[model samples]
Target: MLYCKDCQLLCEQECPQCGSRSLRKPQANDPVLLGVFEPAIAFGVESILKDNHIPYEKFGNLGAAVTLYVGTAMETYRFFVPYGEYRKSVSLVEELTGPAEPSQEHE
Candidate 1:
């Protein structure tokens, strides 16, 4: 099984379809599938993934959600893995990036 060190998400030991353990990790060596977000965040994500040898790609410059929604934007980026590696990717991102701060309620 491939493990995402950043997020601690584990990919299945074997691929259901091919039964291969060739799970792809998002790293600088591989092409990352990026989503939209702020430049700082994007750079941070990339750096983390790169540092951990994860493959990824950056997309969008407008914003995070907009890139995911309209499929076009700037200032946002994301890293994508194969379907088999989805869970691991998410976990890694979460671990490396950490969870977002909770919103404070205003009285």
Candidate 2:
């Protein structure tokens, strides 16, 4: 069995989706994609950045309105930060959601 490391799909011979016979595996130096998020999460991330002084840019994949309205859009979103600030930004976001309240049983 063959696999497409790029798209992480199991294939018979070649990647029918990406049409690549020799897909390269990702390396440590490769940039990390945080996530594709819904609007709420997108806005929340933006707010978190603003509050923590972390800079980011939105890479939206918003497709046709007709498709969105019909709930058939494949649109996704990505946010990026510079390589230098990536660690700091990730740390801040983690801290924000980290251990807000103790468990109710403990409380």
- TM-score, prediction 1: 0.39
After TM-score superposition, the amount by which residue 76's alpha carbon in candidate 2 deviates from its true location, in angstroms, is 3.2
Candidate 2 per-residue lDDT, tens place, 1-107, comes to 35456644334667765788884443433343444455666677778878877666766665567446766344455666544555676676556544323211110
Error of 1 at 62 (Å): 4.3
Score each candidate by Cα lDDT: 0.48, 0.55
Q: Pick the candidate with the highest TM-score.
A: 2
Clashes of each: 27, 0
Q: Tell me each candidate's TM-score.
A: 0.39, 0.47
Error of 2 at 60 (Å): 1.6
Best model number under lDDT: 2
Model 1, span 1-107: residue lDDT tens: 35343333334564433455656554433322323345566666777667766555554545556657776434344445443444455566567567534431111
